[model samples]
Target: MNPNDPKTITDAEWRERLTAEQFHILREAGTERAFTGKYDKFYEDGEYMCAACGTRLFISAAKYNSGCGWPAFTKPADDETVEEHRDTSFGMIRTEVTCGKCGSHLGHVFPDGPPEEGGLRYCINSGALEFVADGDE
Candidate 1:
């Protein structure tokens, strides 16, 4: 993606596409409940994309069993698909990951992951993702 890409949807489009709660959480960087996300028990071969911008963020192959009460991924589908920011909110220093295309806040990334490849855990919110199962219409 280009460095000068626009990172938001039109106001009308956002209003039409999402509910108030979804818009607040996905677009405004709000957080959802710990175990209330949709993808916490998701186990399928597919791609996880940003609900706001449809940007492919994680692949089924990259998902792992983190047991952190959330869907975990060891790596993103592509490095550029998600952008990381230094989040100092909530009185903690964490790396926040958001969709690069629309800047929708998904969740945070942590270094205390399995000692496998990448060695990082992308703890994501299910409200921020849409799973497209493999070979589904």
Candidate 2:
């Protein structure tokens, strides 16, 4: 690992950097209850960043009303910003999305998105993201 890599951050340090909810969702791969997230119904122009490592993940324009009870995006701002892995947890087979910089769990991706937007939905947890509204950069 590289020096000062976010992935190398210790749990104790993370506790100091994030709230209990954020640590649970980002580090423990926990999910917030559907429709309870702050960003679920948020619609503004800007970027969504990883709550843990602050890595830019999605753009506001990609957001859509998937009615999945969480914030949904058509695509990531950049494919390299996130990493996908085969997740078989909770007795289900799914693709888990993680932060490329720190390996924090964001959420899962599904193939049932809007067809005009390539048919992929990045179902993310609100606790896993921080929204930076447009012009607030």
Candidate 3:
């Protein structure tokens, strides 16, 4: 909320810290249109962190192609960076993913993942993540 208060940032501060597009998607829960996200075709070894909070959410090793027009992962980078809750939004039942540290909405988890593992898919929006390139590792 309050981006500068350290507890939570004010909406005004968030607007200043992020571009209009980032703010719209991150703070306002606006979805980036399908197939247009930067990570849709990405294939590199790195970690994906929260764009707003810098908390690591996924590792490159967990990424996969679900043809869902967004970056998808079979699992999170770690179990601690995300929290899952049952979402009843849109009149459908689903598992919602949020940041563990700041509670920023990341995306949702589905059961249609790669069947070899468990068919669990963590469908994430690329706008929700800030990828730290492998070179930075």
Candidate 4:
């Protein structure tokens, strides 16, 4: 899906479309516990898309093991695929990352990443993503 032309899904539709855990994370901006997300340790050749809207966000090449208990990507598939906002929750300032297409909370981005790899860590929640393996479709 194009991030520029986001779909307008309603709350009722979202609740029905997603699982409880997925709804919590994508719709209510809730987070899954560290080390418990499905994609934290998943490494494969594929693309990661927003779980809610299926917008392409990250590719396997940009993913790395950051030991951050979440899927980490050095960069997005496209600059406009994700959106960032200043988050001041829990007494900490963070850059929250969301799917630009559906405006669903994906995770947060941090500055402490491999300097050789764009110097950014996009710490994303697995519950917020759906992976499409290379050659799968």
Candidate 5:
């Protein structure tokens, strides 16, 4: 599937392409346990892409340990790569981040973050992403 146009894929195709857990989080807007994600503590230099559509969402340079129990980044690789929406679930108002290509739920973006760095925390799910090491890409 082309990362630039994931909406072309049908729901059945998404179910067939992703695992149960991935489908739950990416498609159903579910979240993984805090601090349990594979990339929560991962600090290797790399680029993080949308697991479903392979859209480049973040980079190692922007990744930071915010003690938020998830992979946090100061910013995405490009603003256009992610789409933010006002989420009002669970009695809380928050901004939900999704892959611009496929509209898959990645996580949320919070205002609390290192002020020195953009002051935005991109709390992302590892299951929603796939990493490609700097040199391996």
Candidate 6:
């Protein structure tokens, strides 16, 4: 496996790198409790990146207070920033979002977003993201 590539990293390696909560949310496709995420109320100007692979996923400009108990975004950094999969887990049809580069589970996307901004809410997990405040890196 390429040490520099997230896509090639083994599960053991990922376990070594991520915390238990992060592993559960990112690797196991688990969901964090609503309103418990650090970024849920965080509004710093920055970019949200994939925690495992450091791939830029969302920008602060696209983020909004959707009151959904999680960090909500109008869109990704780009069309290829994240991938959406039809999730049927737990008997509910939802769209699962994942990091485009490493395929780490980010969260889910819902269609009940503000209609003005393309009407899509990218409800993402804070554990799946690392906020890089503007001018910090």
Highest-TM-score candidate: 2
Candidates ranked by TM-score, best first? 2, 6, 5, 4, 1, 3
lDDT of 1 by residue, 64-133 (tens): 7788888899888997999999999989999999888888889999997877666899999888889999
2 versus 4: better TM-score goes to: 2
Model 1: weakest 10-residue lDDT segment is 1-10
Residue 102, candidate 4: alpha-carbon lDDT: 84
Q: Where is model 2 more than 4 Å wrong at Cα? A: 1-3
Q: Best candidate, lDDT-wise? A: 2
Q: Between candidates 1 and 6, name the one with more favorable lDDT.
A: 6
Q: Could you give candidate 6's per-residue lDDT for residues 22-134 as a string of tens digits?
A: 99999999989999999999999999999988999999999999999989999999899999999999999999999999999999999988899999999999999999999
Residue-pair clashes per prediction, in order, are 0, 0, 7, 0, 0, 0
Tens digits of per-residue lDDT for model 3, 48-127:
99887788999998999899988999998777988998988789998888877767677889989999866889988888
| Candidate 4 global lDDT | 0.92
Alpha-carbon local distance difference test for all models = 0.84, 0.96, 0.83, 0.92, 0.94, 0.95
Model 3 segments more than 4 A misplaced: 1-7
Clashing pairs in 2: none
Q: Model 5 over residues 1-137: C-alpha lDDT tens digits?
A: 66547787877989999998899999999999999999999999989999998999999999999998999999999969999999999999999999998899999999998999979999999999999998896
Q: Which 10 consecutive positions of candidate 3 have the poorest summed lDDT?
A: 1-10
lDDT for position 8 in model 4: 69
Better of 4 and 5 by lDDT: 5
Instruction: Rank by lDDT, highest first.
Output: 2, 6, 5, 4, 1, 3
| Candidate 3, residue 23: lDDT | 74
Per-candidate alpha-carbon RMSD to the true structure: 2.9, 0.9, 2.4, 2.6, 2.0, 1.0
